[model samples]
Target chain A: SQTIHQWPATLVQPVGSPLSLECTVEGTSNPNLYWYRQAAGRGLQLLFYSVGIGQISSEVPQNLSASRPQDRQFILSSKKLLLSDSGFYLCAWSVRGPTEAFFGQGTRLTVV
Target chain B: GESVGLHLPTLSVQEGDNSIINCAYSNSASDYFIWYKQESGKGPQFIIDIRSNMDKRQGQRVTVLLNKTVKHLSLQIAATQPGDSAVYFCADSYSGSARQLTFGSGTQLTVLP
Candidate 1:
């Protein structure tokens, strides 16, 4: 079975501070990775997705960026944090083919 | 997708009654759809999925009905339970981009006990 692991379940960062959230997949290779941000009581907004290593597709222009360094390792980063950047960040992975995507526990970031 | 922050459409159903959630998409090329359930402070979980090839699919206690002509989908849950109260999301994907799912605005289901 495949499972996704995400770090820093919760974080409190100051304004203009850097942010780094990591997600790793186990028992799967070359999986499609995606990063999404969901505001309180709002639908999810796709931030970035990667089909392969070193390839990232950004959905919406924002203060955040994503990168896939390894086959099953994806990272979401930001040079400076904004008050609006705080939300529930989720990491998900699906197989190359048609299948259900599994999500991690997610990171609750609060920018004060 | 449009944002409905803090004011998502909600459904209130009595326990033991059936519940139906509806979703609509504008993409005609989408050939796959999926339904997910999200609880408070947690990520969305896969509930069920259906392919464009089929109009309907059944799960343990859930059924997804798809209408390609109208580009709409519906999820029916039998015997609504208190635990079934959550936010339901629908996602659509095309043929070539099977893994990149574009999500629909979610509906909050509130099971009345």
Candidate 2:
């Protein structure tokens, strides 16, 4: 069985502060990783997705960025956080082929 | 560009009654669809999925119907229970790129006792 882990389950950051969220998947290799943000009462917005190491496709232009450092490790970062950046961030992983994704517990980020 | 949307923002159903949630997508090239359920403060959970080639698929007390011509999809829940109350979202994916999923706004289902 594969498990996804995300850290700092809850985060409180000051405005303009740097932000870093990490996601790791165990028991799977070369999986597709994605970063999504869901605002209060809104739908999930795809922020970034990576097919492999150093390869990322961003869906919307924003202050956040994502990176795939290792095959099973993905990181979402921001140089400066904005008030609008606060939301529930989710990390998901899927096999290389057509398979349903497995999501992590998710991180609740609040930028004050 | 592909866009998925739900028909309603909220739905209330009595307990034990059947519930149906509807969705529509604008992308004709999409060949796969999935339904997800999310509770408060939790990530979306995969409920069921259907391939575009198939019109309907059934799972444990859940059925997903796909209408390619109308670009619509629906999820049917039998004997709706209180635990089934949550926000449901419909996602679509293209044939070639099956990894990325485009999600809809989601419909909140409330099961009344």
Measured by TM-score, the strongest candidate is 2
| Model 1 stretches with alpha carbons more than 4 Å out | B1-8
Residue A40 local lDDT, model 2:
80
lDDT of 2 by residue, B14-101 (tens): 9999999999999998888899999988888999999878999999999999999999999999999999999999998886665588
Tell me the TM-score of model 1: 0.94
lDDT tens digits, residue span B39-62, model 1: 988889999999999999999999
Every model's DockQ: 0.69, 0.70
Q: How close is candidate 1 at the interface, in terms of C-alpha RMSD after superposing the true interface residues?
A: 1.4
Docking class of 2: medium
Per-residue C-alpha lDDT of model 1 across residues A1-112, encoded as one tens digit per residue = 8889998899999999999999999998889999999887667788999999999999899999899989999999999999999999999999877777888989999999
- Model 2 stretches astray by more than 4 angstroms: B96-98
> What overall lDDT, based on C-alpha atoms, would model 1 receive against the true structure?
0.88
Compose the digit string of candidate 2's lDDT tens values, residues A39-78: 8877888899898899999999999999998999999999
Provide interface RMSD per model, one decimal: 1.4, 1.5
